[model samples]
Target: MDPEILKFKILVLGDSGTGKTSIVRRIIRDEFSLVHSATVGVDFSVKVLNIAQGLEIRLQLWDLAGQDRFNHLSRLYYKQASGVLLVCDETKPDSLDSIVKWKGELDARLQYKIPAVLLVNKTDLIDDEDEGFSEDDLEKICSRLRIGSWSRTSAKDGFGVNECIKALVWDILSDKESKTPDPLTKTKDVFDWDDDCSSSIIRLGRQDLDLANSRGRARKCCH
Candidate 1:
């Protein structure tokens, strides 16, 4: 059976030092970097990801530079973006606000909202005494931004990295099924960040990816 092909432009936005590039490397290249070289302006990567049985997603992952100086350049990449991943650093709480601003900027530029998810990276440096983003904290933001889901990740260890991408892609697919709301539209406001949080992986069907590119077509929003 031929699986349906879908191509999507997914923007990865976050403040510098939040490990956006590292996460991108882990996903697109299956590698991680120890050096913290910042993304110059905008970096692009692509992967054919498996979302479900008989369904594959050609993800054009755009890793936008987090430097404030590149704000204008970053907004240019938001045009016709299918979804967004707002990466934030666990240690640097201020980055969370930046993620909010980035989301707002994306909507303002695109003239509409698309599915957005949060990836709180740097989980490998866990501090037990530190208070992380609580349910109330997430609820308020999720309600306002309409973020579909969020999860803790460690780009260094490759933990929950793939799950984060899968979650957002799944949300994009749901938005296309009908104008009516579905489970994907519902706020999955929270995900367990504990050691057992591996369960967060999207369980659309069989896992992993292998499909034809052919400029995949299912719900690509951009021309």
Candidate 2:
């Protein structure tokens, strides 16, 4: 018997040139485009992920435009969001500052906080000899924003891309399980965290079903 499939919307919000689109492409298609143009409004792609094995989740990834001109339309995309990836470019210090605005807009439009993970992108640009954003600094920011988890990723090389998806998806599932009224069903919630790599390895969230990833055509909007 086939298990019921659930649909979820994951919003990727960040400033211009923060590699929001690249992150999505890396996770969904495992491909990255260096010459990708800036998003005019909102561009989105779809991917169906099999969780544990029993639960199938359709992730509608919405990459919102970062330009101020398109800010007025942000509310339309924030509706019914299941999770959020608040992205920022690690090499560009200014990109970190822009995260505040993105979060502010999300709060104003959604009127409530949704489960989110902060993606510090472009980690490859940082010097291997030098450190960027100390652990204390990152902890302070995440704590202030109430982020569930964070990862240092390199969309260009696919360093932490898989971790990003796993973390956010786990949060979404945990959130849903807490709200579920059925006490008969048990949620498999055991996961191991790698502090050095800052990623999660889910071991027990298994199901008796087939898992697959679907590549769906995406729609782009230009203003």
Candidate 3:
């Protein structure tokens, strides 16, 4: 018999009201919430996907709370994360501004490099010329941060959300084969501290570390 396929953990990080929860709900449960409620701590769900080559994979998605006080709790979820869905609300420019911080937190706590997909959520809200951010802006941001993959999604309409998740999963699995290195071993090499490059990477690393430490303390408090 073939060995059991390993399960991959994908973390969703973004500012509050960015629709991180909505995307997850739409994908996992085929549900969407018109009245948004802040996620108290963290929410989780799982889905099985079949990729190319008949590879069956289980994705354990952890959705972290985007509030400032709950930010510290994110580190615990990142420990063994295989990938991240960094979400930003396309309708709100301020949420886009916080993307740098969210990405940094993931890098520091996990201390490992993982495939990241920047998701510009609420695409359905784009009203003609009123859309604040453009596809070009997203490309520039991702290029600067070395986040090569990205997608525009509308959880309300279920547009491009599933495709984004599948694409991310495939990318992660593909990287896994090429690197042939454990997640922890691959972290340092993935992030480079270059002054010429955008400061986004460094910011992400520091925030991740801080959140990780904070989560550790929180765990102790629980016990």
Per-model RMSD to reference: 10.3, 9.5, 14.0
Clashing pairs in 2: none
Worst 10 residues of 3 by lDDT: 214-223
lDDT of 3 by residue, 88-203 (tens): 98889988779888877777787668887777889788766545576567767777665646677789987667656755665676678677755533333322223444321111
Model 3 bad stretches (over 4 Å)? 1-4, 50-54, 181-223
lDDT of 1: 0.69
lDDT of 2 by residue, 142-175 (tens): 7777777677778999876676677677667778
Q: Give the TM-score of candidate 3.
A: 0.75
TM-score of each: 0.75, 0.81, 0.75
| Local accuracy of candidate 1 as per-residue lDDT tens digits, 37-116 | 78898999987644333455588889988777887785579878999888988788798888788878787789767888
Quantify all predictions' global Cα lDDT against the true fold: 0.69, 0.71, 0.68
Which scores higher on lDDT, 1 or 3?
A: 1
In candidate 1, which residue ranges exceed 4 Å CA deviation? 1-4, 50-55, 179-223
